[model samples]
Target: MKTESTDANTSDQGLITLAHGAGGRVMRQLIESICVEAFNNPALALLEDQARLDMAEIAAHGDRLAFTTDSYVVDPLEFPGGDIGTLAVNGTVNDLAVSGARPLYLSCALILEEGLEISRLRRIMASMSDAAGVAGVSIVTGDTKVVPRGKGDGMFINTSGIGVIPQGVELAASRCQPGDCVIVNGTLGDHGAAILQARGDLALEADLVSDCQPLHGLIARMLAVCPQVHALRDATRGGVAGVVYEFAEASGRAIRLFEDQLPVRPSVRGVCEILGLDALHFANEGKLVAVVPREAADSMVAVMREHPAGRDACIIGEVLDGPAGSVQISTLMGGVRLLDLPIGEQLPRIC
Candidate 1:
């Protein structure tokens, strides 16, 4: 076994090793040379144990702080439209965004497997930096650890984010009311379909790409026009169906969705048809579901359409008075079917 001092003196051989996580010179160098260089912000440069934030600056954005965290272990880290790095930043940003917050800062933690290429790590770090820039959030502090090659995958990322919810911006599933309009920003299931195809588990071909993007900006635009928006959720993991179910359960109201209004891309629809899947249940990283009073629905959608992310914005459903805590979908065949949450994840590690 190599002594700590000896390991600290050794240089990186273009691959990650256990020494990189030993909390010694090697670990410090890895963080300073790669992670710090990628995210060169003042707060992160301090190299403090915890990020020192300006409370006054935070207070200027809103009265309450909105915080969220998520982990990404998506198989085949790099997909068509994004990679695990992009997902790490955007995922946490969206978590705060859906709560009507202005996403601000993020903390990244990496678990790397030994023998991973240094070049790959650099590329992933750069991706994370770029994604933070796009989301207008700073990566303030982070930690890194290396595990044995077989003990971990290529890498896993965990991101925690903080934002501020402006005054009067109270959003929750309990606020959903009957007659409220349910709207989606864009096509659903693109991310899930893209990941499925990227995995190359089946001999399938489709021009699908992950819709993994930061939704905070688009959500801000929606809230600016319609502050009365009741509930908002990024349709991830369990997808739109999952979000609708949450709203129903929280508000004790029924949600009815119109199948025809759901905007699903042709490639995604094709993938679903070939695999016996429903686009409604597929995961999406960039899409969101919103519930707003009927009076504000049209204007809200109009504003949403003005943004790039919401170009395909449309109302897909409405809150109903019958059958509390139930979600039903009106299929194109003029038949209604209960849209229940999946007992098991259709696409594991999808986000």
Candidate 2:
């Protein structure tokens, strides 16, 4: 057995042994070198069991709090554009942001498998720290655990976030109304396609990277242009089609989507075509689906295109007056097709 003080066991070049999770010297070393050093915030610095925040500071933003939690178990751990760490941060942040909130803080929990490389842990931690900084949020608290080899993937991350929704902003699925324009903020399916390629499951390959990013800034920009936005959802696990179907069911209205207007990257489209999959059903990490008043549709798309994160934004659909709780797509081939909720999983563990 490797001793805790041994350089071979504690160094970054070393592998994470079960001893590293025992809540002793080795565990403390791992936490300090990777988690503490990387995240480096006053709240995290305290090393307390839980993070404490001033209620006054939180209450100043809004009367409501937006809280969300997500877990990332993407295969390959590291992918073309991001890793599980980046995914964990961006996923939680986007969830809060899409609900019309200003994201503020996060809690990170890591599950590491025994025999994993210490360097990999460091790299992921650095990625998480950088992602949190980019989103203007802090990793206020975190926990770590280790599982036996073969019992777990390299690493899994769970992040919980809290944000404040500014006054006068109401966004929800039930807010959808007839004539509301459905808009998508940029190309879809890059994240899912990228993950599939990363897993080496498909023989064909093209340049694809996960569209993982913080969407708070983009959401804020859209709200500034149209505060009356009915609903906003980050199309993640279920993708655009799932989101539209959800909107239809929640609002008890029909949704009509223009197939030609949906922005799809050529590479992603090719991959989906070859794999007999629909890009609309694949997962996305950075894209958003918005339902806004018809009057603000053109203005929303125009403003979205001006933002870096939304340069490819466009109107893809709209809500209808009747034939409630269903979605139909107007195909580019001039035929209308009904879109149903995905019956089973298309891609598992893509996120």
- Candidate 2 lDDT, 1-351, residue by residue in tens: 223333565677799888888998778877876788899998998889999998999999898999999888889899999999999999999999999999999999988999999888889999999999999999999999999999878888899999999999999999999999999989999999999999998885599999999999999999998999999999998899999988999999999999989899999999988988999999999999999999999999999999899999999998997688889999989999898666887999988
Q: Write the per-residue lDDT of candidate 1 for residues 106-136, one digit (tens) a residue.
A: 9999999988877778788899999999999
- The RMSD of every model to the true structure, in order and in angstroms, is 3.3, 2.4
Candidate 1 stretches greater than 4 Å from native: 1-13
Worst 10 residues of 2 by lDDT: 1-10
* Superposition TM-score, candidate 2 onto the true structure: 0.97
lDDT of each: 0.91, 0.91
Error of 2 at 12 (Å): 1.7
